[model samples]
Target: MPAADLPLLIEAVRMAGHVATGFVGKSAKRWDKPDGAGPVTEADLAVNDLLHKVLRQARPDYGWLSEETEDSSIRLGHDRVFIVDPIDGTRSFTEGADTWAHAIAVAEFGQVTSAVVYLPMRDLLYTAARGKGAYLNGVPIQTSAVTDFADATILAAKPTMAAKMWRSGVCPVFKPAYRPSLAYRLGLVAQAQFDGMLTLRPSWEWDIAAGALIVAEAGGAISNQRGASLRFNSADPRLDGVVAGGGLIHAALLDALA
Candidate 1:
């Protein structure tokens, strides 16, 4: 693990985010991926191209995996790889919403060794390193200790798919705040703004790689709905679904979701 590469990784992601922010509301161009539901704007491709170029030039050894590019099985061979989401919330990006952002992280084997998330619209940068702790704009951060579900600032996507799953036979009164970007949503958890978050469907590794590390280093924890720690570099790219808050309420969220 070239753990020493944290600074370079952070700088690359910040620069990549700045480049992506340039295209907001400009109506440059856009398209969909293989699936018609997944939006891919010109900014996504542009930022993707920039990240590929910069990250490759900075750390030639790190394998690359991103949303705008094709899948690669070569990452299985590298102990460390750069997992990136050029623009995590393309829907919000094209809509000129402030919820969108960029995510980048270094995964050693399956663990995230470092992470950096830049919210382009908000000009916010969140970062973390394994065992080193998390920071939001360089200020140290940690998760909320709110154990009471009624008081906990719950968060999740709109329509509340996971909320329905949790309320179907349990915790019917709990209401989690709906959020857009998975990075920013999870960043809220790492920053202690929210206590728990639930994701109903599977997500790409890039979307949560940096967020997961932010949670971890902030003295919080994360896992798929089944309560498993997240890992990157799978051929399918759909890593897993649903991660609860860290700290005391995590177990409760897991039990309710389970």
Candidate 2:
């Protein structure tokens, strides 16, 4: 099932990437979303519309959930759903940075089965299917084997390192890194480019759904902030946070955060 969906997601995400690249540095009209939900651009909506039309047309029975689309309880009734973030880093895209990505996934019974994250400017395509492993540009990928917390290089916003968040009351020492797109951070972890990634604030499902499956298929561990398994297509469409990395580092990070 995942194998069938994998190619579909890859094609959809690649097409979405093409649409997004057209707006890069071209001054696509942008504005802040109401309630400070971050920025949105004409490119975002265009890409969203294209993806919605293409994917839904191909899988009429599948439910739909996208960052650009209004929420609908209709998805909860379907056994399979498509979760998408047409542009995972609006700020990066608007600022003419190349780190933004198109994240897409198919979820069945709340578990993601197939996923893809495409960064057009970077020419990076990350894909994965549950039980089939992860890949980067068609080559297999895996999480870093680093187990020592202090030696790990982690991707996260500076706020995640705040002393109060960890049980130690002082941030555990690890090299810190940052990426504007949540999906790309997870992809980097899947590629073993970083030891792990996390965020303390609530995360949107579209931003992390595809990456979650990629990381898992790459032999990494991922979960909500409290170390619970991550589920997709929730009615609220948000998660407490995300913690993902190689197995030993993932466990150690969870232990330290606890």
Candidate 3:
């Protein structure tokens, strides 16, 4: 069933990307959330609306959870729920940047079964299904094989590298990088473009659900900042944080944080 759902997710995410691209440089209306959640543009809502209709119509029984849609407890009663972020990097999209992405995933009883993360402007599509391998633009991808922390290139925010967060009171020697889209950062790790990625602040489920599967399917390990397994479709959808990389690097990062 997960395999079957993969195609549907891929198609839905691609269409969402298409819808989003139409407004990329066209000055789509922008506004901010009341509690400083972040800026949102009309493009984000348009894509969210399109994905909701297309995905829900195809699987009416499946529940839905999306950044643009209001939260509901009804999804908790379903075995499979759709988790989505119409535009992962709204700030980038509003600024006419190509790094924004559409992230969609199917979580069955708290575990991701199928997922797709698409960046239309960049023309990169990442996809995965439970047990099957991850792919980028239809070609298989794998995490970086580098095993030493000193040699790793990690995608993360500046705060993630703060010395206070590490047990040694010093950051690792890996090259630090930044990406506006959390989903895209995870995909980079899956594609071996970056050895790993993390954010110590709590992360929303919609932002990382799809990328989590992609990294795992690509022969990488992904978990919360505490090195605990990630489970989706929960009553509270926010994750403690995310840390993903090749097995050794992933373990190393967690140990450093500890």
TM-score for each of the candidates: 0.93, 0.98, 0.98
The lDDT of each candidate is 0.81, 0.93, 0.93
What tens-digit string does per-residue lDDT give for candidate 3 at 1-258?
999999998888888877888884548999998899999888889999999999999999999999999999999999999999999999988888899999999999899999999999989999999999999999999999989988999998998888898999999899999999999999999999999999999999999999999999999999999989999999999999999999889998999994
Residue 189 error, candidate 1, Å: 0.6
- Candidate 1 global CA lDDT score: 0.81
What lDDT score goes with residue 61 in model 1? Answer: 86
TM-score of 3: 0.98
Candidate 2: segments with Cα more than 4 A from true spot: none
For 86-183, candidate 2 gives per-residue lDDT tens digits of: 99999999889999999999999999999999999999999999899999999999999999977899998988898888998988889999999999
Q: Write the per-residue lDDT of candidate 1 for residues 121-232, one digit (tens) a residue.
A: 7878998888888999989998988787778777866545443576355453455687778988889899888887878688888888889888888888788888887877
Instruction: Report the CA-based lDDT of candidate 2 relative to the real structure.
Output: 0.93
